[model samples]
Target chain A: MMKIDVSLSKRLGDFDWQARFSAEGGQLGVFGPSGSGKSTLMNLLAGLLKPDSGHIRLDGSPIFESASSINLPPEKRRIGVVFQHAHLFPHMGVRRNLLYGFRRTPANERRIDTNDLIEALNLGPLLDRGVKRLSGGERQRVALGRTLLACPRLILMDEPLTGLDEGLKYQIIPYLKQVFNRFEIPYIFISHSLNEMRLMTDRVLEFAQGEMTGEVSSELLARRGMGTGQGGYSNLMEMGRLREDDGLYIYRWGGQEICLSNGGDQDTGMFEIMSKDITLFKRHPEASSARNMLQCRVVKVFEAGNRIGVELDCHGQRLMSQVVGSAVRDLGLEPGSAIIAVIKASAFRRLY
Target chain B: MFEFSPTDWQAISLSAQVAITATAVSLPFGFMAAYLLVFSRLPGKALLDSLINLPLVLPPVVVGYLLLLSLGSEGWLGAMLAKVGIRIIFTWKAAVIASMVVGFPLLVRSIRIGMEQIDDHLIQASRTLGAHWHDTLLSVILPLSGRAILAGASLMFARSLGEFGATIILAGNIPGVTQTIPLAIYDYTSTPGGDRMALGLCLVSIVLSFGVLVLNEGLVRRFRKGVK
Candidate 1:
């Protein structure tokens, strides 16, 4: 299992950001508010920036140790990063950008095959094209290919999807998933959106004011959101087979199907539905405008401040709904209660 | 109609050689100075920055006077070179040196602007891709700054071609030897009934400057196309 331990501090403008984190194993999702030291942590991990005072270690190697005055440069640390802007060398073609790190890797140490990555990332047509000619989605894919070719022990992605719209984000998510599934190396994915982080990884590190508040499984965070009512919950369902129905697109997941207003013939991917957008009714509302109504059994009902948090099991897939305490009592919602969860087809936001 | 004298031809050829030599020799140093000023965290950086730009702010004759004091036959650098049996004063080499010193700041200023305009993230990306500083400099910074370097070299070359104050003071206007186009033009203008010769050389200077500007633009556009 790969491991990381970092404790660093720096002053930014008027605030002191004390960044600290420790992680082990699977891809870690770093979720935080703006100016919460997420990017600082990434830079520190990648050796782009040194900490004021602390040590950073990866898999037992000392990348940075302030007390010992040991600081390995970014190149020496074998870390790869995909910045928010992609930062592809504008002077280089796609092929050169991808091969830049490949050439730098020692022959015996190189694990990635250039042809395989090019094929996997579908970079064949783009190899000879200049970086400026690529679309945003294509640029991200090329950036991913470039970073992967480096054969880094750790990778850090800083808000890779922040600027992308919903459609473009879905287009890029599979490539990201392919990296984690195919490569054994550990990586930290940073983003401010929980929806984006949820689709990327289960283990998330939430930051606030330059410190990590907690590291929890995505499910637990959603559950916490359900309990608090302040932190709204969302469910990510891994979409399976796909088909077209009239002008709408139908997606199969967990023995049930969800319909989308559009996106027919698109590749299968994951999508998120906000828990607040889902309403629980004791019986099907025959006159509702919501396009999706799944018959589900109430898994649990818990107190959420002045609200009621309902966890439901629909065709073996978990979904959440929040209702006021008065409504919960009026609907007689409780554990093992049967209900129809209503959601709009427009609410099915694809998670690329 | 535009027949030139042997002296005029010799001065034209000497000026071209001196400008090319000055630009060529100073290119690497100017690049390094610009890179350091833009990227390095050296102590007294402000002072270093000011010192690199001193030539642009100071008068050319003043620069030549200082060069004479520091590099004259009896001066410290000249004494050291003299110990090695090398003399630079009142030579064509001195003309090249004078041109280089006067034009150094222009080269540095243009290159520094280019370096400053580069996105730092590109450098960071290269580092994370396992390229060391030298590799990054060669593979990224230099290529991205190609246009600006060309602009700077063109400016320096043009400046060197027209260099008169320093070249006359240090190298002297010796015909067919230390004399360049500008020096020879000065000589022709000062002599009685030499207006035609002076005007011919003046036309040559304008044409040379114009040609350099056109060539620089073409080269910069080609480099940018290759880059994109």
Candidate 2:
């Protein structure tokens, strides 16, 4: 039920910014390419940067307005921001960094307990360790924990995972997901990575050339990436119980079993399969080299660039695949068509 | 080995007193000034930056003369102080003032460099995390720039120890009084057949400056260890 309404404009040299939008905030997203005024939106919302002229409201309260000259300072705004790079105070230990904002908040106003957040962030062991000694993933975790401990009404994360490596990025997403689900804190997740946006956000506001081009659901945003030459859409799956078999990890997803070449001994894991990596066959090929093959019903076929994006239901789980236009015609693919999909064991990339 | 006279010992001790006092007194102002220069988007910032650096570029004698003109009995500040029953000129306090004015730019410069290096996002993060400006300054900016503050203080202290033209002009070369080691050396050189005494004071000056630098280094190493 959290709500945010912003209508602001700013001119930075040649790049002019004009955006007007309102969102019912629950895992809201600001999605765009680089230099698309995404960071501008974040700074404006957080009150880190002033707008040329506009008004911003959160939960029916005007945090900033040009007409009446009511621009709340950042602290008074209570909108926490996680910058691109985790900016933990270098002089403080991990424990102090987490408690910094909590201590600043009034006792009556403070909602989240410090110990609960530390436990959620798994920071017990690192409490006394200085920030300089932490790794990239741990530093980002601390930054997130610190912001959360402040009990912000709305959190603005500007590409928080962009600074970490691919391996570390996936590892941290689970923690982020767990914290958000447990606390249910409204947040506007900002990122250019379509996969990340699809994973972390529910609704996305797309930005291009310093303007909000469109606002769409997170799923449609990922689908839009198909024709942009950034590769086809990615279908992410949250798999249940995990087990290792013959050096391959078998994971349960949508009443289907998936084999992955790489996975750890976690109770549950998330994995992503790109559309391009899935191959559709009319009939089950005998003696196929691919590790896994499943007969799926084609849910839908849509045109994407010169290719066709196929949405398939494999054992009630939705999976996306892409094929050339000629292939779709050759196979006579359409909704309700039973097609066999072959995937390599290495195609499933473990997210956590 | 040089023979130490009681007057020579007094000069050494007095020099220490003046340098330590000047650095200690300037530390807070230097920190504030550096913070303003680094963080504030003031319109007159360029002018303010140049003004702080004026003494650094100007000759010590020129700075001393300016201090004299402004601090003398007939001057505006001097008259204002006179009404309050305060006298600054020709006292050890004047020596401390002279050292402070000469060494202030170095202190501010070192601190400014450190403050500038602190990531702006860190300040923004603290603010967005519900910290007021004062809270951020104390919890984030202050500790982050502590090493630079220490560096600036030590550098200013070393500079103050060598202060000569300004101190002599303002405090005068009165032995066992406002006269420091440098002034004592000046007195020895001007006196007949006092070359050995002048050289002795010069050695003491080198030792004092070296000791300050060594102490600064040791403290910095300990700070680094604590951080890690």
Candidate 3:
């Protein structure tokens, strides 16, 4: 059980930021808009930045206390960070970069085996490669391995998968989950995408301006228009298995089979289907380009500004669809009403 | 036959020794000054900056005169040295001191450029990875700034080889004692039918400076390739 109690105030150029938060968890997600003090809070927690007047404690150890005039340097604070750009040492190869922190830690205190971490992060093949030769995904994987080998009590990741394309995101998410589950240490994953947070954890702390406004579950926040990419909403689904047919991949989900763009080895993970990508049809439309059609019962309908949010139950799985309010009234969508939801194969965003 | 007199050989060897000693002595202090200028937030930073750069804009004769006042036999520091029965004036030590005073700004400028080019995130990343400031300085900053350090050392070494105004005023042109390559060349140029000897010494100075430049470039290339 780890706890973080932060009450700090600092002034940036032309902007003043005040942040206060207390949380205990395995994974806590920090979600806020750009320049809302999320990164500042992370820096403060990592001891890279000092607060003017506050006290910070990690599991009852005083990392920083302004009243007591005590502040530990970042190296002694035992916090590892995975920056947005990885920031691997340019002069070192992948092998040396990973071993940098491992060798620094006391031998008796080392918890992570060097070989095991390399295998887990798939860094064995790229160990001797120079840092300049790594691709974006490969660099991030190395960064994760390096941070893990540090044996830090708490790891803070700042938008680990922000700029990656869709395919790379699918490839990276599984490694993130692998590290998180293997290490018993808690982590703070910071991102603005609610859908991405849903794949990692449900406990999210929301920030606005410079304050912790409230807390909400990932699903509930997604329902409130806090989804991925440009105010979009997505329904994250779990798949059981996949079948290959005619160069297409089919996923068996909710007692039904759905076809997707790619196939992977493990099939038990979440997939994000954007809410706006699904179309409603009164009956099963024939000769359509859409791949999967599921017969779902409307669980609830609510007004979402100019559009309406319709929550559907596909067997036991929940799928959300956003439709124009006029279409809702014309098709008579309500609780217990049965309708067909059509989705394209390209719309399925797999999050391993 | 290109014959060099014993006095000529002495001046060449002495010039080489003085220049090497000046560069070696100023290296650590130059790095410290550059690091503080670029990284630290000293209280009297403006005043310190102007003082460090004063050598660059001032005349070498003036610099030599200031050194004379501070380190000559009658000066305060010179009196302190005299108390210990050590003499620096009109000696090889004074030549080294004058060369160091004239070449210091170039050394500091190149090192400061190198230190400023380093990325701040790399230092922060090192600290987060459990390396203290000392570790970061040794492992990250020093290795990355190697090319600049070499460049600065070479520049100062070449500059000291050609130094004339400061050395003549402080160390004097005493053959076989304090006279260096430039002083030897000056003596030959003033005497009758001494053009040949002066020209030979000038060629020697040119070859030495060219060798240092080539070594500097070669090492910088090797260092960059190693990092890559």
Query: Which is the better candidate, 1 or 2, if ranked by lDDT?
Result: 2
TM-score of chain B of 2: 0.95
For candidate 1, give the lDDT of residue A200: 78
Model with the higher TM-score, candidate 1 or 2:
2
Model 3: residues with Cα > 4 Å off, grouped in runs: A226-231, A265-270, A281-291, B214-228
Task: Extract clashing residue pairs from model 1.
Answer: A170-A352, A173-A352
Q: Higher DockQ: candidate 1 or 3?
A: 1
Residue B61 lDDT in candidate 1:
92
Interface RMSD of each: 0.5, 0.8, 0.7
Counting clashing residue pairs in each candidate, in order, gives 2, 0, 0
Model 3 C-alpha lDDT per residue in residues A1-352, reported as the tens digit of each score: 4788777887877777777778887888889888787888888888888888888888878899999998999989888998878888888899999988887777876899999898889898999899999999999899889888999988998888886776686678778888778877788889886667877778888888877778787777777773333435777778876678887788888789988886567857567787889899888888689988989999999876667888899888888888886898899998999999999988887777
Candidate 2 per-residue lDDT, tens place, B1-228, comes to 999899999999999999999999999999999989999999999999999999999999999998988899988898899899999999999999999999999999988977887888889988988888988899889988888889889999999999999999989989888989999999999999999999999999999899999987876676556444
Task: For residues B184-226, write the lDDT of model 3, one tens digit per residue.
Answer: 9999999999999999999999999999889877866765575
Give the per-residue lDDT of model 2 (tens digit) for A210-252.
9998889988877767876555788788987668899988888
> Where does model 1 sit among the CAPRI classes?
high
